[model samples]
Target: MGYKLNIHDPQDPTSLPPSTRSRLASGRRASESIRVGIPLDYNIATLQPSVRNAWIRTLKALHANGHTLHPVRLPATQRALSAYYVLAPAEASSNLAKYDGVRFGSRAEGIDGTPESVLFAKTRGQGFGPEVQRRILLGAFSLSAQAIDNYFIQAQKVRRLVQQDFDKVFAKQNPLLDDIAETEGTGDKVDVLLCPTAPSTAPLLSKVEAQDPIQAYMNDVFTVPASLAGLPAISVPVPSATEDQNIENEEYTPFAGVGIQIIGQYGDDKLVLDYAKELQAVARDS
Candidate 1:
């Protein structure tokens, strides 16, 4: 998906770094650069109708406005998905352990002779989905004393590496970076990074359920890296021009406009939204 960058308004209430007032007072130019980062794997034909139209509109807008976009293809995005599933659930299991009946949840009443309480198992089994169950199991295994260092610890490292990969590719430096020296001369380090919000637009709930579990997992791959890094990101709908497309065609099918995501480094939340609004305007004009 193509993204247009535009100047941000300092008057908005959700803005960050009150320094925006100082910058405005200092009379610094408010023009922010725009760049679209389309994934190498993006196939226009596979998008839902509404999403496809939006992407087309965004591209047309950027072209008409003389805006240039940079393409970013991360070959490791697939691996990152795998790593996230393993790591996220493992972490969830650790974080969620505190919710046992004794600690912080509704307790089941029928407990007596069993070595393992049926009540706890029943509560969890009914509360979590299959995917959640799988993750919890994996997490439980990983956190066992024998597996802690090898599985849970290594997954944490992979998660860090994923964040580092993003930090390397985007034009902007991560505001959370402790050593600014490492990000020097990184080419304008863009005010925002643009990308496809999902691997594809939202699939029909039935179609999504029928697909392989792994495929469902891949849906979040594009959004995960940003989430892992604690960055600010927004998904904006890009509308298509026409409505006659087929409802079943996975690619080129008209549905909703593709969600083009805008991500910003920590503390640059206002900058991100300001630019998003600018892109929205650009999309409308185009």
Candidate 2:
């Protein structure tokens, strides 16, 4: 809430002179009360009770503020999560390839004059941690000649579907379209979509360590769809009503806040931030 900023386009040098820090130090609210969609059915089954309660409270706050809310579904969300795992690791594998001993990152010793393959392997093995290594290997496997079409190609298609699903819901058409729609904010479609940022509040460190890799990945279930679509999204923390005030003697206490996410269409970054500012105000006033 204390932040101030300005929007600048790097591609357009004219937009760069007014630095973000020089802008007026005040948050802007949406000029009009627009329809908001809440994907109530999106991954609700696996949502933690505390997170679910937090979402419900936020929903009530939004309704009380004179904004319209509706229930909508994006059928591709689950598929998008699977696609993200495939696509992200594949990208990481290719992008991180430059960090070999010869050019980037920390180089391993005792490998001077070795074959390029051995040098690269030793450097990556010594430099990358377990998670990065796993993703790199997964990406490499997905990009392999035999598997590229089956995994990477399919993931790309799913990513397209994720984008299309978002496009279908937002009232404002994606600016990337060849024929941009002239009329915006004038339809039955939602101006923004609201949902939980994660499936749960912060986890106990012990539980985090105990989670298997796939289980850990499931934590991103609610977030990856918007990411794959390249939409502008923000997560605002909403205080949970389930805090245990009497748990002072407990060895571990639950975190009392969960983030609720707001997602808007492509080129709608301003709209997303505007809505986020309003949501933050709602949270504070509550």
Candidate 3:
């Protein structure tokens, strides 16, 4: 039998605890779900309502097939959003610091002009976004001799643990593992693991931007695990049936659709894609 796991609340309470509810209310959780399987083929510029429907139809076809959908949730997935932002920019700051003139890239044209100090300030301020600037400052502080062990080093450990959580659930072992099977299990060990691509369907682009940076960051919580583990995964859209049909409004949509992602072992790209094709076919027939 395929292994099954549920990352949702155990009690099935009508409402979540305040902290959890707040995250959910903010759309952080929903964003985390949808981005998992954004089609590589999707191009924002040319996206049309009809194309979205076509994608949904394809997903519906896949579900009609015999493929079983297993919902896998790792509570740690939520925490990962915080960890990734902390670690990614911490690393980016260090990596990007080399761009400083004299030691790295081209020096400013007005090095000796009036005030050298003001010139350097202008160059950096003009080059970076507020988010980028904040991260760079934070990263620089984290790397300071006094803070290295406390912040940077600890963040690295969290990153590893985050990766471990993913290795635990995926149907296949990470190929990067020294012993593939020993690290978790084999490819044939499980057919596939399934979960919401995002907590909800696509949000308006404006709404998406107005959300908190952390909330926007959560968009990748589900997908990032697969990426961090270097596994192959695909998102297939699952559209809800219409009103005249028996399906509920939440279950099907004419304007939007759900996405289910399929992840495979490192070298099993072909298998994953094949399964995705099968799923698309099933959704169409259904």
Candidate 4:
């Protein structure tokens, strides 16, 4: 393979996402980070108080370093988050159905049962953990003969709307589309989106174990919309505020740095990583 390059990374070089490698095929990393005001989406602001504080500080640092920051609102975030729960579990249920013992499931030999039906039940009962079992049931119910149209079909429609939301914001083309003529009509587009990675910092193991499993899913709130839209995103850790400067919250600790995420349009994974590196560099140098 004989090729020339404008930029390269040796540390985890070849493992780069395919989208990234192809972007570099243009023989350039990217244009300089612009002077445009970075948009801070409204949904991100409603995250845990500590996470928001971290974002505020990070933005302050950016402003201090001479970057304009703009605050914006995204109305589809709530709908998208709701739709992911439905779509992901529905897909998981269909995907996981292959685990029936005859072809692809763990045999639950420990259970004493005669008929094949009993074995199938035992295998599933014993093989899947509680949380996974719950999702499987929910997914099955959603896909059931009676509920398919009401739930699964509706969920699919929601998923497309979710994809449209990102397309308008990014302005970049979605590679999945064959014809770009019908793209979401005009609106402001951003080079990249900056937001918190989770609703809060990591929680203590004991607390996480004790809480309702569904509650834990909320932590993924800020990140799921992009995921549902099939966009590439990366989280970069920005230095935390000092004890005296930190916001006092029982859920957050001094050692927990803010997790800021960068998202780019589909097949724009390389650009997303570039922006994250730039933001992390600024944080480190500051």
Candidate that scores best on TM-score? 2
Weakest 10 consecutive residues, lDDT, candidate 3? 25-34
The Cα RMSD of model 4 versus the native structure comes to 5.6
Best by lDDT: 2
Where's the lowest-lDDT run of ten residues in candidate 4? 33-42
| Residue ranges of candidate 3 with Cα displaced over 4 Å | 1-64, 69-75, 101-119, 180-189, 240-254
Global lDDT of model 2: 0.80
Per-residue lDDT of 1-286 in model 4, one digit per residue for the tens?
A: 9776534446665454554545432312544543222434544554767667667776776667565555445556767667777778888899999997779966878653666565578788888999889889988888889998988788778778777767666656666665557555534555567777887777777778898867887777788888888778899997665642356566665566778887777767677777677788777875
Better of 3 and 4 by lDDT: 4
For 20-138, candidate 3 gives per-residue lDDT tens digits of: 43332111221111212222322234233333454455434434443333334445555555666666678778887766654665565564224536335555665677888988888
Please provide, for model 2 over 1-286, each residue's C-alpha lDDT reduced to its tens digit, 9 standing for 90 to 100: 6754456666776453454324323422587787889875574687877677678788889989999887777887879879999999999999999998678788778754355456467778888999999999999999999999999999999999888888877776675655554555555588899899988777778877877999889889989999999888999988766453342422235555788999988767778898899999998877
Whole-structure CA lDDT of model 1 = 0.64
Of 1 and 2, the candidate ahead on lDDT is 2
Candidate 1 residue-wise lDDT, 61-123, digit = tens: 765665566655555454666667667887889877766676776665565225666447766
- Local error of candidate 2 at 165, Å? 0.6
The number of residue pairs in model 1 that clash at the backbone is 21
